[model samples]
Target: MYPPKSFDIGWPDLAYGLAACGRDGDADRWAATVERRFGDGGTKGPESAAGSGANGWEPAAGGGANGCLAALSVRSALDLALAAAALPRGSEVLMSAVTIPDMWRIVVGHGLVPVPVDVDAGTLLPAAAQWAAAATPRTRAVVVAHLFGTRAPLDSLAELAARRGWLLVEDCAQAYDGPDFRGSPGADVSLFSFGPIKTATALGGAVAVVRNPGLLATMRALHQEWPVQGPGDQARRIAKYTALALLTARPVYTGAVTAAGLLGRDHEGGLQERVGAFAGTDLMPAIRHRPGPALLALLDRRLRAADTVRAVARRAAVARRLVVRLPDPSMVYGADAPVHTFWLCAVPTPDPAATIARLRSAGFDAARPTSLGAVPAPPDHQQGARTAAHLVRHAVCLPLRPGMPDRVLDRMAAVLDPEDWGPAPGP
Candidate 1:
């Protein structure tokens, strides 16, 4: 059977991360290096106009003059941003309806309300229309998440936020196309992640591109006050992912899954807990800290060395192939986006369990996502992100990778097509 997901990191990156643990480099210096790399103003892409990537307002490619900050994770960066902004308590922060649970949890933890903004079904974007409908007097900001490696058009959202005097934050954690592809040109703050399952897995780290200089300075000061992560913890994380890399190879992974089934073990559930960055840790203290030097150095090196352009292109190519092969393309979410990297490639089915079983029979190890959920709608606006809830309820995330055999796509299409599968199995 195929593995469910591939870790974007290689052994070389892990080895460097481990070696950094042995060195006693200055965390501040390393942070500077990492942040500088994040702010590297690559030659203007056809899409982005010229902007200086300096201390002053460097429109993160035309949004605002930009600066960069490194943090433990996107969660840490976001928490710092919210704290620095100091939006009034109980203010509503509109968020894309579908996002990792921690996102909304962190918003709630900061004494703000996370209001869900339903995403368009095909593009997986929270359009301005949805935002207008979701907003109220309490709405103070919009945390627009570009889901499934697709970048949302932000100019309109930015205009809306400006007119309404609301903060515009772009969660690009899953949409890192490459160095040239900075966050939305209009986002006040753009967050990126390099955690285990993210595009460029540094094991653990995050970088924020802050368009507002004052906000950047405030966030930096607050971040510095937090304790640094222990070197031992960084080393342990490196070791854990190293082992996981080996275990997730096709041969070992298939055997492990088979063995777990024979022994009635929930291997997938166990793996999920192991891979979570903040699993079982005290949220307040765990996220409220700076990354250690080892992690910072490794993250800098990864940022400098990664060929995200090639990686993302290949992933998108594979996703396009799959979409064309599928009998009903509408079943796939976010395929309509002009630029999608297929980070999760989730396809919705009426009976996801049966669909998964069929895909497994075809040697695919697709599984339901445990990480994404719908943010709650405010009290008076019930129905609560119906489309977001619908997508999550029936999503069967298929395992699609760049180098997978083309025949795999054909098999997945056959399994997904009702004509081929003869109506999904019933209870």
Candidate 2:
């Protein structure tokens, strides 16, 4: 079993807000800022790195995240992906199998196929040349997701997209701080998520940066026509996000800790129920786009805060111990990422069901993968389905957001010690 907190030992030292959702009750405030920032007549264009040429679009007509405020929400981003699919009904979209179910549902609901693809065993990227070969005429775009804090090899995908004249959609949800992927306008589009646990969790926000003015217009129109999310739904989301922030920030809070104490016996049952619920329904329809000023402020501060990166060994150690102690190790590190605050990708185990159980039993709160495909796959990439399936089957995303305490890290480590793996290793 891997030792807890060992991976996070070298995290860059920085103190920043860990509020995945908006801080306090700033959700509304953030939403307003987003609307103003990307409103109908915004002046700001998309942000571009130095080489993007001087044509960088001005910021939206209004004010928002110092520059990071999302113009949409998680759900809206999904819609934007579908819009870009340009797919015939039921056409397939290849995705890395190691993904969150929510993204899968979004693809299917949008009338696209969900093709799962495999990855490079070592780098956690699509196997060498696999993406190029997997393309099918029906494939419209290739969604290369830069998962966790790691940057995907966007250059490779960009090259492929150019040769094939296909769209390259960048899923920048988990890539909090990354190098800019902006090239010429039509080269590709980038989608960023600002959900809780994301680099800049602004309550609920997302953005799809497009170079094609026409495509951007289409996405913007879809967003404008989107049904207004109701109050109850909004309230529920707020509550859930708030609870998540609390649990993530102070999981040992009296209420949750006490509940675990009283209900640890049925922890497995609870996990099963949660998994079942997650499997049965799509949690997307409930979320909507609404950006405000407070969110923008928080995003700016958080991004600046992130300038101070620290080692997450303390958290990664806990995740590793749990991973090793689990019955399965085949998929322990499909993402092959180095140890950070936690084992950040999906993993292969005999039973995610049981492993989740053990983690909860040990007082660790883990979550499923983030998302799979909202963008379509390329025409030649038949392996997209395989990649996505592998991601689902083997990847294991761990929880290692900012601000976790040392004590909690120690407790987690104690539970996953190799000695606790049932047999001592030979010295």
Candidate 3:
């Protein structure tokens, strides 16, 4: 039972973890730097300043060439963006009805109302008309998340936001290294995640780019006041990352998967739960923690070796092969996007659990990305939102990683036959 996908940690991550155990000297130096810059509580620290093109930290194309802010995660970045935007309390923020649960929490936590907009069944993105229909007088902002590495229709959404005098925030958490990767030139702010499953896994971190200098200043101020992750927290992260790396190593992963199967467990799901169960006191939301030097070094190494262009090309090639072999190519989400990095080669079906079971039986790992049944929807958009929600429940994400073996793709395609997974046609 090979899991659908595993963490991208490798030798470098292991080395970093080993070094982190005795990195007291490096940690002390970082603490001194933090104290020197932020001790007074009035000046910004090196970590906060790193996003401002200082200390060799420059914004990437996906993040835009603007002042940037680093955060503990994408949720934190969104929190900072919402605060910096200074929308009136309880202002409406339009977002796709089908999105991560954490995103909804962050929006509501910021004293903002999340207005859910229905998404297109094919592309899994909200249409500009949908956005307009969802907008109310209280709508102050729109968050366009590029789901599954599909480039959202940013140009149209941007125009709509402009006409309504609404701020546009691009959620590029899944669309980095994509075509038009800057994520809507018209966006007031853009956010990118480097979490475990993202294109560039930094164990955990995120970047937010602000187009306006004033907003950047405001976010920087907020960052300076936010608490940093303590040494214990950092140590826990290192241990978790290392454990995942070892568990997912080729030699160990098969046995781990078998053990999970013996216990009647879902390999991927169980692994995610285990990895996320941290023991230390939880940091406050939106706290800006400086990644340790070792972690930063590992991230830099991963980025340099990523070769995103080649990786995207490989993903596109695999997607093309999958489309030709699958029973219904049109059911593949993001197939028609302007550019697709195929972060998740998702296909909408009528019964995802059954399909995944079939694929697993056929010796191919497959799973659903997330559950949308719990997401809230507005009355007016209920019909369309329900459609998207159903699509999410039945959407199967096939394994599509850079340099994946062709045999795995073939097995996945074979199991996708209508006879095995159910009828391909859907309303």
Candidate 4:
């Protein structure tokens, strides 16, 4: 029998995989260089532009010159949530049904009650009316995620939250520095993830943009109280972060689990469950005025480079034709949206299972939606389900990771052409 291939294409690009450790020497060098170049500009202290003072983020907080670090990922979001919910209990935290499990886990971890709202088709933005309808007397906050690097309509959501006197938490994990959404100032809190595969990855960290001072102070305290690695453990942690950034072939910590399943070495749900479980670790809780100065500098520089890469992918995505075509809403409403990971063309094929199976056999690794039933809301609110199912039936997420070879992209696209497959089988 032939041996399995060395590389596995899965969701979350391997280029940004967490499986490999960080590069110590390179990271050290980068750190020193960044310090020399950027100085204390974006560092997590009083000197930071993200407003390191007792007040809001300083202008020098190390994102773009116009940008400041914000807490928005799973790690630091806990701190943001705790601060937002200062009430004794019975607070209602409205969340979207289209988000990953991490968001729900954090909401439940806090003493707040989660009320999930449905999303619109195509773009998983929750209907402002749906949220308005779900609001009750105890509603304390509304948390919305910009899933798949697509920004959910936060303006309406934020306005609704404001009208009802509830805090609006914009989950900008996927929408990193893409563009400023309308009503950002209206939000009580906004968060961003700088994880390994995020739009702007510093390997592991997040920023929360707080419009309220009291909440910011409480969030800082909560971060300080959380568990931290001992001095002895810092070396190991830093080492891991370094390798993960530099290594190209390391088995991605996150993707390896799913990849193993795709390779048939593990039972179904093994990889998915493993991934969900590992999301609980606490990375950075406190907002360092200059969190990972080296990383901040790198992120600042990489954003431009990433935009260049994304531009090319966008052109390709626009040109490609799928075998089965599903209509997509053209033009993202948000001015600052990231280049999509997939252009998302769909087919109307009857047997998606067999189609996926065939693709897997032909050395391509395709995936089904992971957030299908993870939302806390009822079945009806999961409009992302219909969107995802529609996409999955005839669509495949081809490899679009940064630096992915164009030849591979073309080959994957070729497989999706309906002409390549025979007539659809009838029921």
Q: Which 10 consecutive positions of candidate 2 have the poorest summed lDDT?
A: 2-11
lDDT of each: 0.80, 0.46, 0.64, 0.45
What local lDDT score does residue 399 receive in model 1, on the 0 to 100 scale? 85
Task: Report model 4's TM-score to 2 decimal places.
Answer: 0.62
Clash pairs, candidate 1, are: 57-65, 58-64, 58-65, 58-66, 59-64, 59-65
**Candidate 2, 295: how far from true, in Å?**
5.9
Candidate 1 TM-score, C-alpha based: 0.91
Best by lDDT: 1
Write candidate 4's Cα lDDT for 1-427 as tens digits. 0011111122233332322223222332232333322222333223422233232111132322122223223545554556545754767777775566656656666667777766554455655677877777878888777665455446777777777778777776655533333225677766766564454354444556566767765765554454432233323433554443332232443355356667877522443343231344552333212233334333333332325344435533543432113232232221124333332222333455665566555545444444333455533333233433333233333333334455654565555545443221211
Q: lDDT tens string, model 2, 251-329? A: 3343554575586554323433432212344455544444433344344333323222333333345455555544444
Question: Which candidate would rank higher by TM-score, 1 or 3?
Answer: 1
lDDT of 3 by residue, 1-427 (tens): 4556566556655565446535543422332232222121212232344432343233211222235665667777777788888899878889877777777767787888787776665666776677887777889998777778788558888888888888888888888762225456788888877677676566766666667788877876776676555546556666777777777665587788677789998787876566542213243332445555444434443444435556667766877777777877766776667767677787876777788878777656677775233247544434446645665677788866656577777777877767544322233
**Root-mean-square deviation per candidate:** 5.7, 9.0, 6.4, 8.8
Q: Between prediction 1 and prediction 4, which has the larger TM-score?
A: 1
Which of 2 and 3 is the better model by lDDT?
3
For candidate 1, lDDT tens digit of each residue in 223-317?
A: 98999998798999999999999989889999998999999998888988898899998887899989988898677666755476788889888
